[model samples]
Target: MSTTVAEVPDAHGPTPAGSDGEELPTRPTPRRSTLGQRMRREWQMHVFILPGVLFFSLFAYIPLLGNVVAFQDFSAFRGIFGSQWVGLQNFANLFTDDEVLRAVANTLIISLLQIAFVFPAPIILALFLNSLIGERIKRVIQTIVYLPHFISWVIVIAIWQKVLGGAGPVAELLDLLGMHGVNIMTDPDTFKVLVVSQVIWKDIGWGTIIFFAAIAAIPTELYESAATDGAGSWRRMWHITLPGLVPVISLLLILTVGNLLTVGFEQLQLQQPAVGADAAQVLDTFVYFRGIAGGDWGLSAAAGLLKGVIATLLVIAANRIAKRLGTGGIF
Candidate 1:
């Protein structure tokens, strides 16, 4: 055949591996750094947390050793080391003590009321605040609500006393209306209600901060799409916003449950003189009155230890329940 011009590979065509008579080298894998090396590299971060560690050790953790006094006939003169170990006698005494039992009942009652009423106050307020159309009005209202949180409880109690005490305006108005003025601050029958109300007013604004942040994190697109699909303000909030807040709400609820036995000591202590111990006594006040004020150190410690154990157990149970319900808890 008149030789057809032999087909030839283009000069720039792909070449097979080793076709050029050279082998490509493989890359070496990187080695992982040792723990020591990692620690050295992140040493600055360790330094930053060191002060917090020291502070907690000094003020929080180290003091835990004092809980041992619960089992001892502890004396200030003999000290923790030299004290007589009375075992569970102190605990037995706690169960038998009417004051302790009453304190427990009062604590549970107040805590339950707070959990039911005060806990939801912030959620409702945050939702209401977020729905405001005017930014200036919303901000002004937020400032007013937030101011009470910063004021000391002393001032807060005083303010409430001035507003609800027998000679206060509401009381005066009631008196003028034919119903005699009553001192709400000192009323045993309604002390629990007053406590819950004070707590709601004081912390609701501050508590809403987390919920508001949660609301902000929700994708704006969800609300816009919902609106485009004919959803109203309440519908958008109910469907989109409320679901976004479940996590924060669950976390706070679990924490609140954990603190069931520990009511506000200073708050109750201050009002106890006016309302009497039967209405105002709680676990915290029980401990204070028994241990420091009454010099029943062992009994106080036992009550404290029991409170701590129950709180820890409550946290664990709440965490488990939250996990089962599909909202993660603050473990």
Candidate 2:
């Protein structure tokens, strides 16, 4: 009789207890690790990351626990642990508070203006810069434009105040011409426009860097191929350059949406004295007034938390829309 080795069963396979079959020892999965092994393998990377992890834990994570105060009537004397639970009282008050509502309205208005105007300025500036042939002139222009971004908001505000104030160069020039001086800094009607203009003037140059880098990254082969196909400069820019910028544009838009409410506390705070809270108050400055100045810690914390949650949702929705439209996402 010819018995085939293929008919033989392994010890790990099905076996009858009464047949004197021995149990096979199980082996660990190739990818499975004991905790000690994993720690030993990743220890170097963990060591490298420890400081950053510690800093975030200390500064960010630890402070997050204080958000519980938002749900309570927080008192400095009673401490966070001992506070009385208020259950939406702070949030309720936020809607009813005139200053808070005004701040919310002003914030939304300024943010929309920024989205419409400031967002496009950099890309346009970048395209202009990219088209310039002289490298030396390009570098000089880039340096001059980027200089404003490094200037402190205080100095920027001071300069603007000096220029647009009743006695500054612009106003002085108007005075010499026997024309009425425009006090734009204190005009509530033009506050949103002024803020948007300031954002463009201050950060537009620095913002161009990302778009310029994106423009530079476009393969020369694409433009060469387009040229071979009889495409003009305008056609190349329309077909290739703009499309190349879409990813960066989408990313920045999503980030901007996420940070819509965070229009620089110091900038508005400095301007508020001139424009008054009604005109200059945004959500950030509102938080500062309530939390730091007014000492209504719970109310301010709730407002801030709400704003953050809204911003996060906006970013997520924007990313989803971008992905559906066939653009690269932040993820």
Candidate 3:
């Protein structure tokens, strides 16, 4: 009889059947979980943020629905649901109103002045404080400066009036010296200066806290190395300190541009009567006087809506520009 030869299978050959001649099924790959399933799995993590989410939904987002008033001839009597739709009539009127135009102009000018002068005050103060050698003196100065920020606007205005008002100490001293005291409080030409100065004085120190923190984060080794290499104080600040601060400066610049139309409402409103509306009216004051006080609810709502839209656009544009310049932005 001839000997029978069994054939051997290659490594890449198809899977063999079992001894009983049955093929086993291959295991299926796992699929990703759906969003709902993921949310369920992470439910506990989300619970921590639930209160904040609810708060914003209630106060910030839900109230946005009220912007419908901008498109309607809104009436207090008829209410939001019952108001007659007027399309763009309110917005048309807003653009045509001379007082509204003037308010926009004043708002722009004051915002520009603040950006140019007041915005940098805090940075300068932070730099000065950071340069100090004594931590105790730095803490004391910081406390004194930050105190003004916590004071109420009413008290702040009152303090300003006492110091610079027509019959205040400066005026009294000027009278004794037979010299004319400058009327800073009521002068339209000087109102811009006064407002910017007040902002710097009130918030400069508080604003510096962030900058101080940024400066402190810089490694002392870098400064010591720079000094060892014969680099002067100004050179180190220019090369390292300012470069480190560029990201922060860029972020703040974008925010400042976004708020270019919103100079302090309370500050402007408090002093408006003293200097007259022509000198002090801003978008906020315009909304208050035209809407709440004057009862032209729809028109004022249109103005406010416009301001918000412009601010949003400004933020978007500024972020884009910052990105182009290679500075990271606040998204």
Question: Would you list the C-alpha lDDT of every candidate in the order shown?
Answer: 0.92, 0.89, 0.91
lDDT of 3 by residue, 1-331 (tens): 9999898877878677778989766668899999999889999978988999999999999999999999999899999999999999998998789999999999999999999998889888888887788999999999999999999889999999998888899777877888786767888988988999999999998999888878878888989999999998889888888888888889999999999999899999999999999999989999999899998999999999999999999999999999999998897
TM-score of 2: 0.88
Candidate 3: clashing residue pairs, number: 0
Ranking by lDDT: 1, 3, 2
Worst 10 residues of 2 by lDDT: 15-24
In model 3, the worst 10-residue window by lDDT is 9-18
TM-score of each: 0.90, 0.88, 0.89
CA error at residue 16 for candidate 2, angstroms: 28
User: Compared with the true structure, what per-residue lDDT tens digits does model 1 show for residues 1-331?
Assistant: 5878866757776553466777545557899999999889999998999999999999999999999999999888899999999999999999888999999999999999999999999999999999999999999989999989998889989999999998799899888889885778889999999999999999989988999999999999999999999999999999999999999999999999999998888889989999999999999998898889888899999999999999999999999999999999887
lDDT of 1 at 286: 88
Per-residue C-alpha lDDT of model 2 across residues 191-308, encoded as one tens digit per residue:
8898889989999999998998899899999999999999988899999999999999999999999988888788889889887888999899988888888899999999999998
Model 2: runs farther than 4 Å from truth? 1-29, 34-36
Quick one: best lDDT, which candidate? 1
lDDT at 214 for candidate 1? 97
lDDT of predicted model 2: 0.89
Better of 2 and 3 by TM-score: 3
Error of 3 at 25 (Å): 13
